[model samples]
Target: MVTKTSADVVIVGTGVVGVVIAEQMLDAGHSVLMIEAGPRVSRAEVVENWRNSPLGVKGDTSVAYPSRPWAPHPMGGEKPEDAYLQFSGPDAYDQTFIRYAGGSTWHWAGTSWRLTPEDMRINSLYGVGRDWAFDYETLEPYYVRTEHKLGICGPADRTQQWPQTGTRSAPYPMPALPFSPGEVKFTEVVKTLGYNNIPVAQARNSGMPYDGRPACCGNNNCVPVCPVAAKYDAETALHRLEKKGATLLVDSVVYKVETSAQNKIEAVHFYDQHKQSHRISGKLFVLACNGLENPKLLLMSTDDRNPNGIANSSDQVGRNMMDHPARSFTVTTKEPFWSGIGPVVNSGIMETSQGSFRSEHAGAYFRYNNFARNRFVTFAALKKGLVGKALDEEIRRMTACTADIVAAHEILADPNNRLTLSDKKDWLGLPKPSIHYDVGDYVRKCWEVYSQPIGKQIAEAMGATDIKISPKFNNSKHIMGGTIMGKDASNSVVDVDCRAHDHENLFIPGGGAMAAGACGNSTITMVALALKAGDAMVDQMRGA
Candidate 1:
C-alpha cells in the first residue's frame, strides 16, 4: 500500500550533512522528515560484520556495510570493482560510499580540516579553478559550529595547525591526540628536509568524553567502523535529531522531486524496499544525497515543464565532478617505525598545498599512512615463498620497516569530468551513474613537477631502501562539484546558499555544492556548507 506524509522540511539522504540540517531544523521547532535509501544497522552489527569478513574483504571498508541490491555502492577488492559506477574516461572514479543509514561517514578517517581563506579564492589568487561564491570569513562561524557539534580535537596552538593564520573562532573541543612513534619519527625526519608535519584536526575524541561518546582509545580501526563511538559519525546526529522530533524513514529511496507551478518544491516521491511508492510533501526540500547521487536524482526527475530534469535549467546539474585524486608510494625504511598505533591518519604535510606553483599545476597534501600493515605484509610474505619462522620474521620486519606515503593533489573544476545517468539500470530499474573522469593536466603536472619529487625526497629522508610509486592516480573518495555553487545560475546549479536557482524552495547541500576541491579531506567543509544552508532554510521557514 502507498502512503503519504507532510512536514515542514523534507531531507533526503541521512548522511552527516542531512543529519546536521535536520538537527538545526528540529532545534528551530520545525517538523522534519528524512529519507534514507538503505537499511539501519547498529554499530555492533557493523563491527561484527567487519570482524567476520574474509581476508580479502577485511580491510575493504565498503564490505563492512554490505550494500543492498536496490541501493548499490562502489566496492573495492583485490581488483577494483566498477559494478556501481560505470567509468568512461582515462581514469576510473572508483569512489567508495556506503548507502547505509549513516552514509559514507561510516568509513571516514575522521579528519576534519578547514579550508584556508586563500583556498576559497583560488580563481582570484592562483588564476585557476572557480572561487567559492563567498569568502572563508563568511563560512568561518559555521566551521566553528561544525567543529563544536562534531566535538573535534586538535592542537590549541595555531602553529601546529594548517594555514597557521589563526582564523579559528573557538578552541577545539578537546586537546590534540598524541602522535605515535611512527608519526614522531616521520615528523623528525621530514623536519630535516624543511617540511612541516602538523597534527590533523580529527572528529574523534582525545582525553575527556564528549557528546555522549567516550574518548578515543586509539583502536586503529577508524575506518570500516569506529567500534567505541569515540569518533563522530552521522548516526550520532541522526539519533539526536530523532530525539528532538525528526522523523526518519529507512529503506526509502527518494526518486523524484515535485515542484509547483510557482517553481517551489512541493513534494518528493520515493520507493520503499518493496517498490511501494509514497509521496512526502514539505514546505522545503533538501537533497543531501552526496555529489554523484544528488545530481542523478535531479536529472531523473524530468517532467513536462522540466524536460531537462528539475534543477537542470542551466544544464549543469551533473557537471564539473571533482575529487582529490591521489598518487601513493611505499618505501622500506632503514629502521623499525611501527605504524599500527593511534589513528589510521593523524598528521600530514600541508605546506605544499599552497604556493605560486598552483597557478600552473595543482597543489598536494602528503601523508604518512598509519593503517596497520599486518594484512598487507602477510600477503607479501606468503607470496615470497617464506614459511614458518621465516614468514613470521619477514612479516614483522615488513610491517615495521615499510612506510606507505600518499600524496593527494587538488583537481581543478573541469566540466568534462562529469557524472551522467548511464544507459544501464540498477536493480530497481533506475539508471546507474556513469562518470567520465580525467585528472586533467593540472593534476598530472602536479604529480610530475611537485608530488613525485617531494615524495622521493621524503622517502630518501627516511633512509628508504626499496621504493615503489604507483603508476596511476587513485580516488580519494572526497567527491565534489556535481551540483556546484556559484553566484550566477547560467553555468551553475545552485547559489551561494546551496539553493537551486530553478526552484526557490529546493536546497542541495553537501559536497555537491563545493566549487573547488581542495587538497585535504572535504567532510568538514561539506558540513559547514550544510550548516549555512540550514540557516538559510530556517530563515525561509520563519519568513525572516
Candidate 2:
C-alpha cells in the first residue's frame, strides 16, 4: 500500500461545493487536499462532449460518462460511481454531477435562484414537511456574501422571498441579458394580470469580469462546458486554493473513511488508476463528494467502530430522497420576442410557491421563477440561421413565436424514498448506491394545481389555439434530498451547517442535504450554503 503525506484537512470531492469549501479553508490559512474520482478535463471537452444535441434542448448524458454511460455497469467510469447511487425501479436515474474536475457545474444553465424563507420552516409552514433547524435569517448574510463572491446577475428581489434576502452591497457583476420579443409579451400579460415579475437572478456573466471568468458569449452550449468560460466553475475556486498552496488529488478513488475506536477519523483509504492502494490520515476529513456519495462513502466505511455503518446511530444515512418534479407547458404566440434563448425575463411569479397540503391539497407545493417566457420562440425563429419549412415560415411571418413555461413540481420525500447501497459493488470493491424514488400521489396533486393553471395562463396569454403540458416523461435536471439534514439525528444525517450529525469532522454540502426543496432552482442556494459552511467551519477548526 502506498502512503501520502498528511493534510490539515482532506476533502473527498472537488465539485463546486468541495472547491468552494477548499478555497474557504485556504483563505483561512488551512492546509487542504481535494480529491476527485474523475479524470482531468478541459473547457472545450466539457462543451464538446454534448456533441450535437441541438441548440435549445436540455442536457444530454449520452457522452457524459463514456465508461459507465449507463449504471449497474459498475461505477468504473469517469467520476467515482461507487460513491454515488444509481436508482433502478418505477423511476430509474443516476442523479449526479460531472465526474470531471468541476463536478456538474461544468454544464449548468447559470441560472441562480434564492430559496424562499418558507423553505426553512417546512414543518411550521407546510405542517407536513420537516422544518429546518435554522431559519432563513441565519443564512441571509451568507446569501449576500455568495452573491458578491460568485458575481450574480439579478434585480435583487428581497421582498419576494418574504424575509429571505436583502438589497446587496454590490450590483450584479454583469448587466442583465437583453430582453427579447417573448419577454416583452410575457411582461405585458403579467402586468395586465396585476402581478409583478422580478428580474432573473443568474450566475452567468452578462458582459463584465466577475471573479475572472469571461462574460456569457451566446455559445448556447451550457449543458457542456462554456467555450468562453462565462459560467461559474468550482475549478476557479479550486485553482485559488491550489495557488494558496493547497494540495489536490485528481483520479484518486477513496474506498473507505477509516475511524478510530474513539469515533474520530483514522485515515482515508483509496486507490489510483494503476490499482495501487494508499492511505492518508487527517485531523479532520470532509466528504463533500456531493449528496449522493457523501452517505454512500459513510456506509462503505464500516469497520470495528460504529459498524452499523459510520454514524448509523439513527440508521438514516441514506434516506429521505427528494427532488424537483418538473411539469412544463408549451404555448405559441402571434408576437415574437427573443425566444427563451438568451437570458433575462421581465417577470416571474414566486407567490404561493411554497406552502402545505392544507393550502394546495398536494403533498407540498413549489413555485417556478420561470425565466423562459415568450422567449421560447425567439431562437426558434433563428432556426440555425435558416428560414424554411414550419420554423422558417413561422419566422418569416414576421409576427410571432412559441413560448414554454416550465413549472417544476416539488416532491417531498416519503419516509420510504431513498438511495440504499446495493449488494453489488463497483470496480473498487465498494458497494454501489441503489436509488428508489418516484413522484408520489400527493406530489401529482401539487403538480395538477401548479401546472394546470400555469398552462391555462400561457394559452390565454399567447392566444394559443391549444396548449398541452410537456409529457410527464420529461422529468427534471434538478435533484435533491438524499442525505437530508434536520434538528434530530434520528430524522437527518446532517445539520444546517452541513456537518453530519453522525460525525462532527464530516460535512456533506450540495443538493444532497436539502431538508426541503426550494420552489425556485437550487444551485444558487447550494453555493450560498457552501459559503456558509466555509465560514462556520473556520470557527470550529479554531475550537471556538
Candidate 3:
C-alpha cells in the first residue's frame, strides 16, 4: 500500500473524456493525475496483433488488443458467464469496450455526429425521453472546441451537415473525405426515394493535416485499428498530455472513491497491476469512465455517508440506461458497388432521423456500411466448401455485389433498462457489471412501422437481387444515460456541466451523463460534455 502525492485534479479512466479534461486542467496550470485500468501499448503492436489474428477473430473489434485479467472488459465472443459484463434481459447489452489507456476509441469507427437541438428537447417536443438540462445552443461552443481538438473532418457546406436544421458556430476543422464508389452509389440510389445521404463528420485527418497525425491513407481498417495514425483515437492525445505535464498511470484500476465532509470527493483508491492498493488525494475528482463502467464504479464505492453509493443520492447512478438499437439490411445489388475504398463509414441518411413522426415512434438514421467485403465473402465461400478457382470467383463476385444498410434507431431512457453490480466477480475479485436492456416499443415501432418500410424501398431502388433484414435489434455500442444529467437534483445524477449534484468537487461526464440517445454516434457529444465539465472545473479551481 502506498499514498501518492495529491494533485489539483484526479481523473479515473484515461478515455477521450479523461484526456480532454486532463489537457484542460494542465492548460489552467492545475496539477492533474489520470489513472487508466489498462496497459499502454504502441499502435504498431495493435496493428501487428490484428495482422497475426485468425480471420474468424478479425471481425471481433477487441481481438487485436488483448485484455488484462485484472481489468476485464467485454471481448467479442466470450460466453455469458465468462464475459466481463453479465446480462439478464430480453435484449443482450453485449457491448465491446477496451479497458486500455486510450479506451474504446482505439476500436471505434471515429464517427462524430452532433445532436440537433430537437434531439435535446425530445421529451418536451415528442413526449418521449428526458430532455437535456441545457439546449444545443448552450453546448455549441463546446462542440466546436471538441471538433477542433479532435480535428474533425466534415463538409464546409451546411447542406451536407448531419442535421441541416442545426446551426454551427464554425465549420469543421477539416474538409470531409470523398465518398467511395459504393457510398456514392448508395447516396444516389437513396436520393430517388427523396432521402439525402449526407457526409458524416468524422474524427480523422483529411488530405491536409491539422493535428500531429497524418492524413488518412484509406486502408479501410478503422474498426480494429488504423494502421496509420490518421484517425483521432484517445491514444493519439496521450503523448500530447504527457508533454503538457499531466501524470498518467496506466493499469491503475480505481475501485473506490473516498469522500470527506460535505460529501466532497477526497481521494480515490486504486490498484496497480500487482494488485497493490494506492491512494491519491485531490481537490477535485472526475470519473470519465464509459456509461456502464461509471455506474458500476459508483455503486461499488458505497460507505456510511453514502448508504446507496457516492453521488448516487438520486438513485439514478446505474439506471435509465440507453443506446442506439439497430437493425441491418444486407443486399446484393444488381451492379457492382465496390466498397472498402476509404473509411468504413463515410456517408449516412441523417435527414431520415428527424420528422414529426418521432412523436409516434423513434426516428432512425440509415448508414451504408463501407466495410471491405473480401473477408466477409471469403468466409461465406469457404462455408460452402468451394475449392480453388470456384472459391476465388465466388469471393470476388460477393465482395463486389454485397452491401449493408444499418438502421440505427434512437431509443428512450428507461429505468428498467439498467446496469447493476453483479454477484459474479472478476480476476481481481471486483464486482462485474450486469445489464438489463429492452429496446422498448418506441424503437420496435420504428423498425416495424418506419425503418423496415424505408429499407425495403432502398433495396428495391438499388435493384437488389436478394435482400435480408436482421430479425433482432443489435447495439450500435453507443452507450448513454446511466449518470443522466438534468436540471433537478432528485432525478438526475449530474447537472448541466456534468457535476454531481450530491458532491460538489466530483464530476461525472461523458456518455454516462447524456440525457437522450439521439440517432447518431454519441462520442462527439460525450467529448463536448467533457469540455463543458472541464470549463466548470477550471472555474471551481479558480474560485469562480
Candidate 4:
C-alpha cells in the first residue's frame, strides 16, 4: 500500500523553478509538498562515481545519464548527449528535457543569463511573434531576487538592455571567476575593435564563497558531476526547503490533476514507486512541471468538464514551443594558455544585444564564450609510461590550444514549433509529450553572418591553426512555451500573473510560460518568473 501525505501546495517538479517556488512559499508560510520522480542525489556519490568511472561519466544510472537520474534532461556544467533523446522524421528535435530534480541543470554549462527586454515584447515592438501579457518591468524585481539567491557574478551590461538590473544591489556573493588565455586574447581583439567583451554571467561562486556554498575549484569536470558543489543545482534549494518542514515525495509521477465538477481542483493523483495510487488535495494547484510535462499532465486529466485539458480551455497548453537555436564553432591559436578556469569563466563579446539593426526578421546581439576540448586524465590516471611532470605539460599544451565561441541564438516564432500529446504513453499510460520544431530562417541567417568572422578573429588572436566546425548544435534544451503569455487568451496560455485564465487556482511558472524565446542560457529569467508566480499564488491564498 502507498502512503499519502498532504500539504497546502503540491508542487509537481523538483527542478530549479519548482525548488525556488517551494522555498519561497515555505518562507511565506505555505505548506508545500514537492513531488519528484527522481530520488535525492547524494553529492558524495556523484563525486566517487565520476572519479572511479571511465570517461568521468557518472555510473549510478543505467537508463542513459550516468550522474543524472533522467535522460534528455540537462543541468549545469554537464555536457549534453545527443544520444539521450532519439527522434525520427522531419519533426524530431522538438522533445528534449531532463526528468530529474534540478532538472537539466545537472549537465548545464553554468551560464545564467537574464532575458533581454526585447524578449519580453517581441509582438508589440515588431509585428512578429506574440506580445507578452506582462512586460519586463513586472519581472525585473524577481530577477534581482533570483540573482541574489543563485550567487551570480558579472558586471552590469547597461548597453545591452534594462540598465537598472540592480547595479546597486549587494555585491555578488562571490567575485567573478578568471578568464582563460583564449578568452583574454579574444577580449583584447574585441577591445581593439571597440566592442564590449563581457565575462560570463555564471551561477557558481569563484573568487569568494557566498550562501554557504564552496568556491569552485575549477574541477574541469563541471559536466557529469562536480565533486565540489560549485554550480547551483535546484536540489540545494529543495533540500533546504524540505528541512524547513516542506515535504518532498520521491519517485512519484503525478498522473493527472483531478478536479471537481464545479471547476475547482479536487486533488492530484499520482503513482508511487510501488505503482500504488494516492491522491493529495490542496486549496490551489501549481504545475511546476517543465514546458513539456506541464501540458502533458493537463491534457491527460481531461474530463467531460475539460475535454481538451485542465486549465487548457483555450487549447494553448502546448503551443509556441520556443527554444534558442545556438551556433557554436571552435577555433585554436598558439597563445600561451594556463589556468584551471576552463569550467565557466571564459569571456567574450556582447556588443550586438542592444541598438537597432534592421534585418528581414527580428534580430538582436549575441553572446561569445571560450570552449576547448578536455583531454588527458588526472595525475593519478597517468599510465606507467607517462608519470613525469614534463609529460603533463605536453598533454596540457595540445588540449588547451583550442577555444569555443557560442553566439546569438535566433528565436523562431512559429506555431508549428510546439509540443503535442503523443498517442504513445509512458509506463503508467500517461501521454508522453512529443515536440515538433524546425529552425527558423532567421536562425540560418544569424549563423551564416556571424560564424566565420567571429571564428577567424578569435583564431588569429589565439594563434590557432586549422579552425574547424563542431557538429554539436544546441539541442533545444531551453524549452520556452507551449503555454505562452499574450494579450489575447485565444493565442496564449496564461495571463499576466501566470494564472490559468480558465482556472483561478492553477498557476504555471518559468520558461514554459515565456512569451518569447531569449538568448542562450535563460535560467535567471526562469527563476525570477517562478518567484513572481509564487508571490501571485500567495496573494490569492490570502484573498481566499
Candidate 5:
C-alpha cells in the first residue's frame, strides 16, 4: 500500500462539515488533507446534466449527481437494484446524500436555522430525547459565526426572526429575500387561522453579495443545482481551503481508520478510483462523513484490541439513528396563489415546533412548498386525455391554484433505530450500510393528533376545495443521531467538544454528533458543532 505522511490534520468527507473544519484548520496555519469518496464535477456539468435529465426525474435532486460504481449513494428516478443502504423497518430510511467533492450540499434547500434553547434541553425540560451536553447559550456564538461564514440572509425584525427570544447577537448579514406572491398570500391566509408564517433564514444572498459569491437571482432552482454560486455549498469552502494551501483527494473512498495501541487514530486508509489502497498519516484525524458513513467506517475498522470497532467501547458507534419524520398534503385553492416566482421554499411555520405539548407528542415544523407546478400539472392533464385548449386551461388552473404543504416532525432519539454494517457487500467488496428505522410513536402521534389537524385548518382557511393528506410517514433527509453525544461515555460516542470519547485526537463533528434532532433544519446546528470542534482541535494541537 502507498503511504503518505504529509498532513497535520486529515478529514474524511468533503461535505460542509468537513470543509468548515478544514477552513478553520487551514486558517490556523495547520496543513489539512481532505479525502472525498466521490468524483469531482464542475457547476456547469451538474447544471447541464440537470437540464438534459427527463422531466419525471427533475424533482429528484440526486439526479444531478449520479452515484459512482465504487462510491455509491442513493439515486433518484429509477433506483438501482443493488442500492447501497438496505432498509429493514416500518419506514424506509432512504437517505439521499451525494458522496462527492461538495457532498450532499449540492442539492440542499439552503435553509439555515438555529436551535432554540428548549430544543437543546428536551430531556431536561420535557423529559423526552437526550439533552445536549451543553446549553444553546454556549453554542450561540458559533451559530453567529456559521451565519457569517455561510452568508445567511434573514429578517432583521425581532418578531419575524426565529426563536424571537433575543438569542441572536448580530443581525443577519443580509436582509430577508422578498416573499413570493404565494408566500405572501399564504401568510395572510394563515394569519386568519392564528398561525404565523415566518420567512425562513436561508444560506443564500438576499440583495447584495457578501462572500466571493454573487447575490441570489431567484432562478427558483435552489435544489438539484444552483446555477449561480449564490447558495452556500461545500464546493465554495473547498475552493477556499485549496487556495489557503490544503490538499484535497477526490475519488478516495476511506474504508479504514487505523488506531495505535494507545487507542489514538494513526492514519486512515482509502482506496483510489483504481481500487489501490493508500494510507495517510496525520497528527489529528476527523470523521465528518455524515451520520451513516462515519459510523459505518468506524464499525468496518475492527482490530484485535477494539474488536467491535475503533470507537465502539460503549457499543454506541452506530446506535440511536434519528431524522425528521415528515408528512405532506396537497390542496387545490379557489384563488390563484402563483407559487412559481421565487425560491422553491421561502417561508415556514416555526411557532408550532416548540410547546409543552411536545412532552405528550412530537413537535413539528411546517413548510409552504413553493415549487412550480407546471411540470406536475402538465403530466396530470395529459394523463386525463385532455386535448388542445382544455389541457392548456387545466394546466394553467392547476399551476395557479395548487398548494403543497409539508409538516416535518421532530423525532426523539431511539437507540433501536440503528445503523449497522450489512452482510451484503458493495462493488468494492465493502459492507453496505444496513439501517433499521422506525419513526416512533411520538412522531406518529404528532401527525395524527397535531400536525394533521393544523394542516387541514390552514388549507381550509386558504379556501381549499379538495385537500388530500398522505397517510404514510416520509423522511425529510435530515439525518442525525447515529453517533450521539452525552456526558457519559458508556452511552455516547463523542463528548461536549465533539471529540470522540474513546480517542482524544479523533473528532467526529457533524449531524452524527448531535444529541437531539430539533424540529428545524439541522445544517446550521451541525456547522455550529463543527466550529466548536474546530476550536477545540486548534487548542489541542497548540498544546501538543
Candidate 6:
C-alpha cells in the first residue's frame, strides 16, 4: 500500500544544503519534510567503525559509514561493473562520497571558501567557461549568512583572505585556526617567490564555541568523522531542525518527482527500505540532491507532458559537469616540518588562482596537506625488510620528513562532461548514475604551463631531497554544473535563484546549479545558493 502525506514544502535531501533550507522554511512558519536515502547513525557509532576498521582501510573515507543496500554510494577501489557509479572517459570521474544522512560532508575536509567576483564572471572577463547569472555582490550576503550558520573560522584580516578581494561585508564568525609548523614553513618559503599562503576559511569552530557545538580540539581527524562535534557537518544540524518542527524521513530513496499538467511539481514519490512506496505532496518542491542524483531522479520521472524530464525543457539537465582536477607533489624535505598538529587542511595559496592568463588556461590553488603522515609511512618502512627497532625508527624518520603539496585546478564547463542514467540497478531496482568526464584542455594546459612549474619551484624551495609529481589528474569531489544556472532559459536548467526554468514552484539548488567552479571548496557556495533558494521559496509560499 502506498502511504500519502503532505507538507507546505517538501525537500528531497538532508545534506548541508537541504538542512539549511529546511531550517529557513521552518523559521518562516512553513511545514517542511526532509527525505534522506541513507540511514542515520550517531557520531559515536561512526567513530567506533573507524576505530575498529583494519589498519589498511583506516584512511578510506567511506570505511566509517557503510552504505545501505538501497542507497549505495561509491567505495574507494571498486571495479567498474561492481561500482555504484559507472564511469567512462579519458579522465575518471571517480568522485568519492558517502550517502549517509549527513551526505558527503560526513567525511569532507571542512574547507569553506567563497568565489571572488572574477570567479563568477569568468566568461565576460576571460572569454572561457560560463559566467554565473548573477555577480558575486548578489551572493555575498548569502555567503556571510552561510559562514555564520556553519560557524566558519578564518583570518579576520582582508589580506589573509582567500580571494584578497577586500570586499567582504562582515568578518568570519570565529577567528582562524593557527597553522601547523609545516604550514608556517610552507608560507615562508612560498612568500619568497611572491606567492601568498593564506589561511583557509573552514567550517569548524576555533578558540571558543559559537553555536551549540564545542570548539575544535585539534583532533587532526577532520575527515572520516570528527569524534567531537566541533566540526560542522550536516548531521550536527539534524537535531536542531527537528526541534524547530521539521520532519526528517531516513531510509527514503526519492525516485520520482511527480508533476501536474501545468509542469508545476505537486508531489514526490519514494521507496523505503522495504521497497514500499510513499508519496508526499507539497505546494513547493526543492531538490537538494547532489549534482549526480538530482538529474537522475528528474530524468527518471518523465511523463507525457515532460517527455524529456521534469526540468529538461532545454535538454540541458545533465550537461556541463565540473569539478576541480588536482595534481600533487609528494616530497621528502630536509627538515622535520611536523604537519599533523591540527586539522587536515588549514592554509592555501589563493593568489595563484587569479590571473589574466585564465583566458587561455585554468587557474589553480596550492595547499600543503596537513594530514598526519605516521599511518601513511608505517607500511613503507616495514616493506624495507627491517626488524622491530629499525622499522620503528625508519617510520618515524619518514613520517617527519614527508610533505604533500597539491595543486587543484579550475575546469571549464564542457557540455560533454555529462551525467546520465546507467543500465545498472540498485537493490531497489533504481538506475545508478553514470558520468563521463575529461578534465579538458583548459585544466591540462594550466597544469603543464602554469601550476606544475610553480609546484616544482615550491618543492625546491622546501629543500626537498626527493620530488614526485602525479602524472594524472584526480577528481576533487567538489561536483558542480549538472543543473547549470544561466540567464537564458533556452540553454540552462535553472534560473539565477536556482528555480527550474520549466517548473514554476520547483527549485534545484546546491553544487548542481553552479555555473563556474573556482579552485576552492564549493560547499560554502552551495549553502549560499540554498539560502537564496530558501528566500525564493518563502516568497512563493507567501504569494500562494
Q: How many backbone overlaps does candidate 4 show?
A: 26
- Candidate 5 structure quality by residue, lDDT tens digits, 84-141: 8888889888887889899888888899878899999999989998999998889899
How high is each candidate's TM-score?
0.98, 0.85, 0.98, 0.86, 0.98, 0.98
Quote the lDDT for 73 in model 6.
88
Off by over 4 Å in 4: 1-3, 56-96, 156-173, 337-342, 358-372, 376-394
Q: So what's the TM-score on candidate 5?
A: 0.98
Give the per-residue lDDT of model 1 (tens digit) for 215-285. 99989999988999899999877777877888889988888998888878889998898988899998889
Quantify all predictions' global Cα lDDT against the true fold: 0.89, 0.64, 0.90, 0.64, 0.88, 0.90
Give the alpha carbon lDDT tens digit for every residue of 1-544 in model 4.
1124677777888888888878877887888888876666677765665566655433222223342322223323332232333233344453345566666566566676666566566656655566567766667777678878887776544443233333333444455577666556666766675666666667887767767777887776655455577777776666588687788787777888877878877789888766788888887677877877787778788988889988777778876777776555555557644433556444545445433432334343344443234532333234535657866765676556555555556475577776677665455655546666766765555556654465456556556675665453465367787777665777677877777777777788878778776554667777887888888888887884
Worst 10 residues of 6 by lDDT: 1-10
Which pairs, if any, clash in model 5?
none
Model 6 gets an lDDT of 0.90
lDDT of 2 by residue, 1-544 (tens): 1125577778888877887778888778788877777676665564565554443442344354333322122222335334445666566444545566667676566667666676667667766667766777777777777767777676534453232343344455555665445665666676575544445666777767678788776555554455677777676666677678778887777778887767877678777766677887876677777666776777777877677677667777777766666666555556554453554222355544644542444422222222333234447567557645866575544334455666666666565776777886666666777877767765667666655675577567666654667666244556567677777888777787877776787777777677777556677777777877777788888998
What does the lDDT read for residue 118 in candidate 4?
A: 64
Could you tell me the C-alpha RMSD of candidate 2 in Å? 4.8
lDDT of candidate 6 over 1-544, digit per residue (tens): 1123788888898899898999999999998888899999999999999988887888787888888998998876677898999888899888877777888888888999899999999999999999999988899999999999999999988778866673699999899999988899989999999998989999989989878889888899998778897889999999988888888899999999998978799899999999999999988889987878899998898998899888998888888989999999998888887878899999999889999999999999999999889877788888999998988888888998988899999998888998889999989999998889999999989998999999999999999999998889988889898899997999999998899999999999999999998899999999999999999989888994
What stretches of model 5 exceed 4 Å from their correct place? 1-5, 77-81
Task: Give the poorly placed runs of model 2, Cα more than 4 Å off.
Answer: 1-4, 51-58, 61-89, 93-96, 156-175, 338-340, 344-347, 355-400
Looking at candidate 1, what is the lDDT of residue 143? 86
Per-residue lDDT of model 3, residues 59-150, tens digit only: 88887988998888888777887889898889988788898989889988999999999999999999988899988899899999999999
What lDDT does candidate 5 reach at residue 338?
Answer: 84
* Candidate number that wins on TM-score, 2 or 3: 3
421: Cα error in model 1, Å: 0.7
